[model samples]
Target: MQTFRTEIENPVVEKDIIDLANKIELFHKGKIDEEKFRSLRLARGVYGQRQEGVQMIRIKLPYGKVKSNQLRRVSDVSDEYSRGRLHITTRQDIQIHYVDLNRTPELWAELEKDDVTLREACGNTVRNITASELAGIDINEPFDVSPYADAMFRFFLRNPICQEMGRKFKVSFSSSDDDTGLSYMHDLGFIAKIENGVRGFKVMIGGGLGSQPREADVLYDFIPTDKIIPTMEGVVRVFDRYGERKSRAKARMKFLIKDVGLDAFIELVEAEQNAIELKTVAIDADVYPVSKPVSVEAPQVAIKDQKAFELWKSTNLIPQKQDGYVAIGIKVLLGDFYTDKARLLADLVEKYAAGEIRLSLRQNIVIPFVKEDLVPFFYTELEKLGLVEVGYNKAVDITACPGTDTCNLGIASSTGIADELERVLKAEYPQYLTKDDLVIKISGCMNACGQHNMANIGFQGMSVRTPDKLVAPALQVLLGGENLKNGKGAFADKVVKVPSKRGPEALRRILNDFEANANGKTFYEYYQVTGERYFYDLLNDLQDVTNLTQDDFIDWGTNEEYVKEIGVGECAGVVIDLIATLFFESEEKIENATVSFDNKVYSSAIYHAYSSMVNSAKALLIAENKSTNTHAGIISQFDELFVESGKINLGVSFSELIYQINKNAPTEAFASKYIESANLFLDKVRTYRSPKPLKGAK
Candidate 1:
């Protein structure tokens, strides 16, 4: 499925991913067909993801290097075409969302001036080549492998053998044995080692741990540095030939490598690699130096004193082999940077700090080295850009992927929810920023974009409505998920199902209680020390179970609702927006269409339909308050809350929401009635029958 060609040797390129900067200049004036231009720009690897109506563009960082100009370009692209922020991905790639589909090509052409590219960033294609964030530095490293990484990337970029594989291929480079920088969670993880007096690598394959998690296996314990590419070619061959094709979920190299076992897989890899006669450059010390990256201008840190500079120095600095220079890591919250701020920072990096910047896996940015005297000025400049925040422990530092906001298969907006949760954590529990040894990740779907299964607390998106009612589905919460110091990271705790909106609060409560009562212990230790009986007792005591009675259902004109309930987490992203979006600045532009909520006339099902309605929903409106076909106890529970009556008058629907927000007086004030309403609305939706698309609907 792939055709090989060089930027020059390739024949007629109907697609020019890059072009004269003049076209880019024209597009800035809104004078070009940017989308038409984007389809051709090669440097910026922008492509549509699995989901429809969305674009996933990948920005290349040569050897994971970031320059001030490059960062400025990234910020500019994001501000002009995307959501004015960028996500620093685990793969060391920067991703922008909700891209103005029309402007991508123009963006690509402009990117070429920097020599960055997006080709092979994604698809059933080879992805952005990753390397150790500490490739040239890290005291324990054997040698800088940046050149090798660059060589392999250049050789295979859009190569016929790799362009369209049976599945996506991921690659990484490591300069040390401890696999923290280049994650072992990859299809190909190459860590440096010395074998038989020769500088080489320990190549591990298929080691991703998401959803159906698996550890990558080490096939070649010692691959001479010179032959790394051929070895990589071998692994790709094994993956292409044996990886599963029918089930996309099972097609990742992690699955194939696990299934075939390392021995057989390596044999296959070796076979394919043998066919290639690699006649390339010699591997020598002069191949690539461990010098400071090419500097456009020397920076002058501007601060006068040392105290502020010391704090900045502690958090922002990383040791590099280059003398008189240290790498400064600027922790970017949630990998988001405002465009104007980015431009200013780029200018600052150009003026006060290093001319280049590097994006880190921890969703942070780095600028390598300036004189100790300039560190203070650089700190002040960074402070102006809001890029100097320090992070602590797993919980408050969350990782979330874009969900339904701009992705195709997204079941929810994990990013928005993550942002909200981060705000809540920062505002409410100041201690969690430094105390909790936990991670919270939100995935838009069960596909594990958020790595839900690996977090101490994780959420995966899913549909939870019943047969008759159709409302926003909920997240399938996988509680007690964790990864301990390279130990077996457990997935969700199966028994507890919580609605997504309530999840943050619930987790907060648990942590709060643990912090208060546990005798000075870590979060995980506290949970373990407290044991299950105490944990359940505390949870039960917190919520008065007696209040959840059949009488509660009476409020909806239905018989008392009670049921044998099992829990499932609601997809938090989509459901949470039911209210938040009703208030976000730009979104508030849409005026409300007033509707009468005659609680006496519309039965619970009708009410539920109206309350739960959002972008896409199916509901059959009727006047009757009772149903002849259903009995009292057939239906059991809603994903959001437990319900008993088969045709329960659970008064919840989108119409009810429009009614509430537009009330003459706040109807659900002073009480958490909105939460109850959400649960009830979700419950009613769980009862919808065959969903039929609305005809002539907008």
Candidate 2:
């Protein structure tokens, strides 16, 4: 494992991998707490899969961009460390499953060799920053948003502020008003816009998709591109300080905004502006690498089936602004593909195109900068690799998560039913192959990893019980959701819950009604006109569980009887209440603060120091059996119990001492003073707890 130290050139990355290796050893030796270890490993992108004793490594790709060499490197790592299979996530990340936990550091080091990383790919950190897959080449875009998305990813990769928040924060960049990046459902969403001849973005805040979906509120009609980074910083700072920490369900930014009005949330965000490191971060789009199409003669090829080729071309070709060039969309069924196809696709794009591919949010692949004349050649090559699926971003192209296949929180077989639905569409509703208006998404549970709640037609995996007390796999059918461009959207209404075995029949019924009565309107319009009650009545017959067959007891992708076994999810990482662990973590936060101070990142250093003080106070509060839920609550309680009560002397209220973070500018003097204050505070808390040994003190 030490060999990676020599191979990795970047010292920071090298230290990260070494730290992960050391932590794993400590965890195995029972030195690190299990919950603490889970948080640490998750922040490093190592996730626990549904299968016991295995891990899922999510490789972060900013804005879904992947160079040919990077793709090849990832494929090699997957082949070496995993089972030669890669799963594309809805966030545009690549996940390889069934990996031994001990080999993760080496696997991560291998990925970083090609400038690919697994850091901040999971856990409470900022997950992958996704963007429009057609960002650079979209004809409708005002300007390429790829550079802005890249800047955001770079600025926050290892930044101290969002490392371990109460829950994860999501960000997205839409290329245009089309909202292809799905801005309406992200925590912070940016849509590229040009107002008054200046490049900027339409900013949205506090939107999210889950069991409870909320549309993002408009923060700004347009803000200059220079303000995006600083604005995001302020938002993250506010969320960290005031967001929920005790209730995992209420930890998302949306809930905070919902609890407090958006106006008040905006006020809090504005309050942090003075403490922000940079008021404006200018992003030079000119420095972003430009993709150039290969200038070679098109290879002559004979089309085996002309009609099939035409249908594929009609559905899969993406129009580019550049003349004589088009991008190809490969509709990856269920988001699962093997490394053999990946490596070959990498080679194909590298030789004939711009040596790059973008992973779509819908878990598909887009090869941009391909010459129009080479479509047939590329089609033939892709056909050999089984990559030429005819329904790219169409009705038949369903998006689903790895439900029951890999995710611990998956309640039903999302992939199995997605497979069956695609087959049904191909056989019965061939016209849907080119129908791009409808979207069908499935999630094994209500977490909406599949974005099921925001699709035109959605299905949520669940279990239903019969009159005889027998449980069977079931799906909740939802209808009428639509993404109405420019940060506006609607969530689907749950119409009915039917047996999983009857899912195909439910789809058939919906499509049959739509085709007969839609009157050439789009799916959204048709759904709006018909209403949820109409769909409920239409699919009500399938909801009957009285005459259940043996097949109803079986889930889609399995042979055994359905036994619902959902494991604890590691989505936001677990909360650790161990007093010793909290104290230990406080020390670690101080160390991080010192490192950030040495690096001259005063804002980050100050936040790290603030976290240390808060953590230390929380430790003492826990010793007193107090509820340390939100940071604000911790500060108030610590002041009441320790400062006012005279248990620990700080000369002032804990709130006044800790609230200096937002009150003062993050200058060197304040950061140095804050670090000293944190150290002093930790010392006082330790001395206070030393004589009175905590009940479960290690």
Candidate 3:
């Protein structure tokens, strides 16, 4: 494990990997708390799997862009550390599961050699920044949003402000007004626009999906490109300070904005402007690397089935703004593919295409910069790898998470049901293969990892009980959700609950009714006309549990009797309230502050110092059994209990000392003074907590 230290070139990343290794050793030795260790590893993209004694590693791919070499690197790592399988996530990240926990640091180091990262892919940090897979090549886009998305991903990867927030933050950039990125469901969303020849974005803030889904509110109709980074920094600072800590359920940014109102949230964000480092960060799109397609003569290939080839082209070929070139979309089944197929696809693109592939938000793959004449050859090559499935982004293409397969929070089997549903779509409802207006998504639980709440037709896993106290896997059917484009969307309404065995029947009835009465209306329009009660009535008969057979007790893709087993979810991470751990974390924050100050990152240094003081105060407050729900609450309570009582005297009140972050601009002088004050405050707090000798006693 120590060999990784010399192999890694970047000192910061090397330190991170080394710290993870040391922490893992401490955890095994029972020195570090399990909750704290979970938080630490999750931020580094090492997640707990459903199976014991193993982990799932998520590889963060910004905007879903992966070079040919990077893909090959991921394949190699998956084969070495995991089970030689790669699972694409709805967030455009690739996850490999079933790896020993002790080997993660080395696995991460191997990935970094190819410029791939896992940092901030999970946990309570800014997650993978996703963009439209069609971003650069979309014909309808005013300009590509890829450069802006890339800049956002780079800026916050290890930023101080969002390192330890109440919950994770999500961001997206849409290619055009079509909202291909689904901006309305993210914490922060940007839509590309060019006003008066100046590039800018239409910004949306405070959106999220889970048990309760909230559509994002528009923060700005138009903000220049230079303002996006600074505005995001301010927003993150506000979320970190005021976001909930005690209750994981209410910790998302959407909940805070809801509780405080959007106007008040905007005010808080505006107040953080002075502490932001760069008020105007100009992103140079010209400097972004553009992939060039290989120049080669078209290869003539014989089409085995002309009809099948035409149908595939109709649904899979994407129109590009660049003339004489097209993009290909490969519909991956249930987002699961093996390393053998991945390597072949990587080689295919590197030889004839742009040497790159973009993973879509729908858990598929997109190959860009292919010459129009080369489609036949590419299709033939992809067909041999079993990647030529029809209905790319259409209704037949379903989106699902690795629910009961690997997630600890799964209540039922999402992937199994998704597989059966796709089979039904192909065998019975063949027309859906050409229909791109409808979407279907499933989730193992209410966390909405598969984005179930935002799909036109959605299913959420659950369990139902009968009169005899027998439990069976069930699904909640939701209807009437759709993205209206340009930062507008709706959440699906829960209509009915049915046994897992009856899921296929529910879908059959719903589709039969829609095909009979929809009459040229989109699924959303048809649902609105029919209403929720109509669908509830249509599938209500499937809810009868009185006559459930033995088959109903078994979840899809499994022969054993289903047991409703759900483990504690680590998506938002756990609250660390241990006094010793809190003090240790405070000292660590001071160290980070000093390092940032040395690196000349004034804003980052100031925030780190602020965090150190807040953490130290929270440590003492926890000792006193006081409330520490928010940073502001900690500061005010510390003043009342400790400062007013004169237990430990700082020159000024705690709030007065800490509030300088928002009051003063982030400069070298303030950063140096703030760090010094934080260190001094830590020393004072330590002395106050220490046992003192009696009067005249040494």
After superposition, the stretches of candidate 1 with alpha carbons farther than 4 Å from their true spots are: 1-44, 49-56, 75-84, 98-103, 279-285, 289-324, 392-395, 434-437, 466-473, 478-495, 513-698
Q: Write the residue-wise lDDT of candidate 2 on 1-698 in tens digits.
A: 23345279999898999999988988898878888899999999999999999999999999999999999999999999999999999999999999999999999988888999999999998999999999989999999999999999999999988997889999999999999988899999999999999999999988998878999999989999999999999999888878898889899999999988999988988988878878899999999888877788998999999999998999999999999999999999888999999999998998999999999999999999999999999999999999998999999999999999999999899999999999999999989989999999999999999999999999999999999899999999999999999999999999999999999999999999999999999989998898999988899989999999999999998999999989989887876888788877788888989998998888989999999998999888998999877888899999888889888899888888999998898899999999999999988898898966543333
What RMSD does each model have against the real structure? 21.0, 1.6, 2.4
TM-scores for every predicted model: 0.65, 0.98, 0.98
Query: Cα lDDT for residue 472, model 2?
Result: 96
**What TM-score number comes out for model 1?**
0.65
RMSD of 3: 2.4
Report the C-alpha lDDT of model 1 over 1-698, residue by residue, as the tens digit: 12322343232221443342444555466544444333323223655554444466778665567777788777776776777877777567788766544466666555555566666565566677777677776777877777777777776665544533445777777767655443456678777778778877787777665567665666666878788877776566456445554455676888776666767776766655433445223466565544444343435545665664565465456777766666667666656667787778777666655566666655666676565445555667767676666442235777776665545566555775677688888788765654436677777776675667666667665444333433333455554554442212345443343344455665676667876887776555665665545555544432332223233222111133322122221111111112122122111111111111222211122222222332112112212122111101111112112223334454442444423421222222311343345444433433353234222211
> Given candidate 3, what's the lDDT at residue 314?
97
lDDT string for model 3 (1-698, tens) is: 23336388998898888889988988898878899999999999999998999999999999999999999999999999999999999999999999999999999999999999989999999999999999889999999899999999999999989989989999999989999998899999999989999999999998889999999999989999999999999999999999988888999999999999999999999989978768899999999998889998888999999999999999999999999999999999988999999999999999999999999999999999999999999999999999989999999999998889899999999999999999999999999998999999999999999988899999999999999999999999999889999999989999999999899999999999999999999999999899999998889889999999999999999999999999879786785788778778888899999999999998889999999999989989988898788888889999999999988789889989999999999999999999999999987887777655222112
* Candidate 3 stretches greater than 4 Å from native: 1-6, 692-698
